[model samples]
Target: MTLSRRQLLQAASGLALTIGIMGLPALAQAAETVDIDELMKPSPLGDKVLGSEDAPVTIVEYASMTCGHCAHFDEVTFPELKSRYIETGKVRYIFREYPLNQPAYAMSMLARCMPADKYFDGVEIMFEQLRSGALSGTFLPALTKLSKQIGFTQESFEECLTNQKLLDALEAEKTRATNEFGVKATPTFFINGEKHSGALSIEEMGKIIDEKM
Candidate 1:
């Protein structure tokens, strides 16, 4: 149903995944800075991006598919971000993978394996599952089931899960984030090269974006 094939595989694999249930932190906390040009460097798998390239503000988020805060941001704040900034040509948003565990690694692979046009759709579904508590059920059996709904068969789903090349690329990005940018948590955002760690609210994000503009 899920990965270990992960978050969904707790029962099948007997693995415990701890999500960050801690409430969102204040945005004023500080972190090491990143060079925007270096931050934009692509991994072997490249990026799954949205928004206009010419937007005045650019946000790069390193997130885990199974992180509770990351899922909550997608369920709540991301839509507004997309509508108000991404879609409106005020911001360019780039999402990168930083899987925290085996299950998350597999989950990230699933998103990357999606068809070109459906990459974001795959990512959205993952977060939706995380947010709505769908993955808490039997994911072992449902893993292929969910994949099939989007055109992946049992064999293909398994193949994608075991794709070492893709897995390695995701790992490389995570390592680079750790060594180069000091990204230690899920949902860490770099707004115009300034570091802020948390599931930021829309008003907080808008303030940063406005400052950039």
Candidate 2:
């Protein structure tokens, strides 16, 4: 079913309570009031991309690093799709953050704190760390190893995690997500702005991607 961005947003408002309880610092840019059309616009915070921006299909995914379901999708489904569809220019795939834990949120922040070219690279390494089930271990320590590969020193990683501006932007995105997109779970997807709430198999996602192609 198709949903106007406003309608989809209204469906998601209730999920914001948990985020609120974390008491994140208030940001001047928070989407305190939703502007349905504006909120639907793609975020500028991620590595801005242009891949057949007018491509007939657009896929948006909301994921958290600590989530096993998200890790599964990254490991099994995304690579094939990246090779077949993304690299081939048939669709525009947007990876958006929706972290469920403080550590996940910190990882997401570090990923975005770098130059655009390194953003996804950091994310990939961090995901690999999670795949190893290291998040249950000390997050900062595991993240330190991932950081070194990308030239992120302990100081840089800590700074990125504590950056109020970065946190604010992420919170804004999360707020926009919950109050506007009905995203209640990790690995949630939006195919052309229509919502899919949970993880699906690589085969299942491939079938959908094939249909879109």
Candidate 3:
């Protein structure tokens, strides 16, 4: 069964309680406006970039692996975005982790544990697993199976999830995004330093990319 948004959030919240990660809170107040320059600053977390660094339009996406909207974008919009803009060198697309739960965090860690060149590949595999219903049952087992497919032995997979340094870096990245950039949801996009939230269609994205160009 497809998890509703509420269910997903609840699941994430429960996971957060167990793992000591901060659960997403409601937007109780207007988000403080952040400096565009600061928002555009390159993060030390090492970007998963898909186009030339010098591309005219830069799209930074803050996404959670367990976010259905993010999965939808990965399955739908990203291919077109990649072909028409990223592959053609009109845009530089960067993906940053903003995991919403322990499972998402663990998946993100697995992705980061791979060689930098393989990071996006790892992300794609995880997204595919989510799409295929493989991520819904016995989370660790599902993740372990996926990890093995990506050349991770059980020992390495366990080590990757427990890597404190990597976890700290990811937490720092998420904190920066939340406090400095006002990111509150998955699939948040900053196109040419303009912040937009939620899953955007290919046409909508095209319009934004065109405007930036």
Candidate 4:
């Protein structure tokens, strides 16, 4: 089946969250820094955070599930970044959804629907499917496959997608990111409140992270 009116509306309102396609510099301008308190304030869905509270560096990533560069970062850089930084307790990571399209918004909803402990794993699988072209097919079916992989029943999947409260919360999160944090695209990184747009490689990210350290 196709996207419902709710799903269609989800994409249409995104970005106003679309990160412009590449070709610009990797790091955003210096004046774009944000206040950590304001950036970390409460949110509708709350943030999906990983790693230690005491980690010296905090990396906040705003991403769209459908963005190719975001996918590339997920596939290539995130694993290393997570291991060396997040898992090692050097960096605390925060992942926020900034869906750019209908599929992405729906997929973001699906990721949040998974058990809280599995949120990051669920997101990893969604990007993995996107890379494998599994999610490139019909909407619900592909999304259903992902849902099943993470233990969702067909009924549960439909129910989750149709939930207005969750949808509203997700929409509010995106809107807040745009207004408060200046997240204009997928794979935007804020390393210690320094905003940088686009997917970043390990070496590139590590360098900035090193400076923060």
Give me the candidate number with maximum TM-score: 1
lDDT of 4 by residue, 42-77 (tens): 568888999999999998888888887888898889
Model 1 sits at a Cα RMSD from the real structure of 3.8
Which segments of model 1 are wrong by more than 4 Å?
1-12, 16-27, 137-139
Per-candidate total of colliding backbone pairs? 9, 1, 0, 2
**Worst 10 contiguous positions by lDDT, candidate 3:** 17-26
lDDT of 2 at 179: 68
lDDT scores for all predictions? 0.78, 0.64, 0.76, 0.79
Candidate 4 or 2, higher lDDT:
4
lDDT of 3 by residue, 94-211 (tens): 8999978768877888899998888888899888877777777567666778889998988988787767677777778888998888887787888887777777888878987998
| Best-to-worst lDDT order | 4, 1, 3, 2
Please, what is the TM-score per model? 0.88, 0.76, 0.83, 0.87
Query: Ten-residue segment with the worst summed lDDT in candidate 2?
Result: 17-26
Model 1 per-residue lDDT tens digits across residues 1-213: 122333334343554445555224546765556898989887668887898889888899988887898888887789999999999999999999888776677778888888888998988887777776666644555455667777787888878876766767787888899899988887899988898888998999888889889
Q: Give the TM-score of candidate 2.
A: 0.76
Off by over 4 Å in 4: 1-31
Q: Please list the residue runs of candidate 3 whose C-alpha ends up more than 4 Å from where it truly belongs after superposition.
A: 1-34
Candidate 2 per-residue C-alpha lDDT over 1-213 given as tens digits, one digit per residue, 9 for 90 to 100:
222323322332222212112212112221222343543487647534435676666777888766777776778878877777777787778888886756666677778888887677777787776677554444455566676777877788667666766766776787778768866568776766656655566666666667766
RMSD of 3: 7.2
Could you report the Cα RMSD, in angstroms, for every candidate shown?
Answer: 3.8, 11.0, 7.2, 4.6
**Residue 208: error of model 3 in Å?**
0.8
